[model samples]
Target: MSDERTETVGRSGRLTMRDIARLANVSMPTVSRVLNDSPLVTVETRTRVLEVAQAHGYAVNRNAKKLRQARTGTVAVMLDFASHRHGAIGDPFIFELLAGVSEALSIRNQELLLSPPGLDDTRAFEDFHRARGADGFIILGQGTRDAMLRSLARRGIPMVVWGAVSKDAGYCAVGSDNLLGGRLAGEYFRMRGRRRWLFLGDIRHAELRLRYEGLCQEAAEDKEVTVEYLPIASMAFNATGQTVSAYLAGGAQPDALFAFSDTAAMAAIGAFRERGLIAPDDYSLVGYNNIPPAANFSPALTTIDQKTDVAGALLVEKLMQHIDGGRARSILLPTQMVVRET
Candidate 1:
């Protein structure tokens, strides 16, 4: 956080409020205190700020020599702004993550500035990262290598995502082994005396592919179990009613079924009821991401506990490390099975 290597954006080497905040990235008010040489800033924080400012080649504006610094003790959690048409398909999971994110920010005596879902180019997400009020961002339901990810990298803002395709890229990511969750699904059914399994959900997503691959591998060992691939949902993975009914209409009654998401599993169960069939008896089932609604369904769903709250906490830790000039990478949390009646 030294300022000796600093590069100001404009001539005269004057720093803007936003620029100063970005330098601190972890918190704006902290940076403002440092700039003002106020007693409010701890010696440790003041030292870090001076180093960052000096490195950025910042020169105080002699004209406005005594301007009060800008610092708004707040951080942000990035929403998958694109997926808000139905009031957040992932709202429950998001709420749980926020609870944890807030708990962490509170330890620093800071608050979170929430950004609503919006429609814009990648710049929208980039704006979230550059906000003067927020310390940085904790992105949920999205991954790195996304358009926003690339833009944030260019801005050098402290950032982290719930998940990412690669762990070793520049940004921070925290997610579970989705493939391992899938393997667990296959293993669960194998022990239940059920074979002829069908997998459903968006096949295009890398998460789904990983889960499917694991399921396939586990199902292979059991000659009595036949795992079938059923890419039911297309553009909208949530559109599951008709999709599930299609396979049912084809006269295929797989003894077991695994879905990529809890919603998909609910849809599958709904289809069974319409056909006068009972779950666990007629067809054993399993779903991933132990989402809230999954447990409340008529037949409580068996699923994979994704530990999304843990992922959120890990994400903030990663961003903090990167802000400290440490190496950034992905952190994988563990997953487990939540076996319920259905």
Candidate 2:
């Protein structure tokens, strides 16, 4: 082939994979397979081809890449109302989770399509199964009464959820051990001689409800330790702060507080300050998710770490299994405590 036809340089003066293969003393198809990250290519051959490509500054052509890949290669990410209703979708925790998912997809040569907020769940799901837009769907958090999920499962849709796992839900899910997390928080409080424990966060959602149940169960054996549940009307900082303020104003004194998220826990701390109270002194507080900002709070937060990185990777791995016509089982990652001032 002519030099211009087979080895045109990109804006960065790029070398084509053909040129790379020639320089690395390998077949052109071998170079192509390595560039596409095909596991069929031997490790030593892939390393050599990649090293040569890197040394020569070879870059894949975008247009050619588009034509090479079959259909739209993407996974649809849908944030259900259970997570978006309180605006928790934009929280630091969610951002971390999404970053993990994005990284996992990048490594697998796929893209992520985030469904528009407030999207009709049925329509988005239909697009995944019928319209052939995304290879599969990943629901960030399942809303209460997931009837739509059941219907789609009956139709044999390939989807995964990042929330509570229940046989009744009838969907493959990947989530942390919320029951263990809540029990840990409650047990710690009881061990510290806390009498009144307050549970914060909405229990209507399956995950929060599981955490609530776990906390209540932990305190069940202790007659002296009383556990109370209060729904977070909204996840907004101000809303959570106001809710805590109202509870304090109503003469409810909690010796320990187990919040559903770091966002809620931090907001409650601010509310406590406004009410002339401090954590671990006046009361002990535990938060979930261990988001980045959890450690920066004034009293720092004691929280349950869900290991977002691992969670994200597992979610993608399970989704890929379903997409490839394999059965994807539910996964429950372990939780650990990050003890800070609170």
Candidate 1, 189-249: lDDT as tens digits: 8899887999886555556777888898899888878888887534233457668887888
Which pairs in model 1 have colliding backbones?
2-51, 3-51, 3-54, 3-55, 4-54, 4-55, 5-55, 6-55, 6-56
Per-residue accuracy of model 2 over 1-342 as CA lDDT, tens digit each: 654324554555667765777777899889888887788899999988888777666677855675566645778887654544455555687778788888998998888888655446566567645655677888787766467777777777788888888877777988988999989998888877898999998888889989999999999979888888888766666778899999998988888999988988988988888888888999999999998888988889999999897988888999999888898999888788888998
Each model's backbone clash number = 9, 0
Which candidate tops TM-score? 2
User: What is the lDDT of every predicted structure here?
Assistant: 0.71, 0.81
TM-scores across all candidates? 0.69, 0.79
Off by over 4 Å in 2: 1-71, 81-88
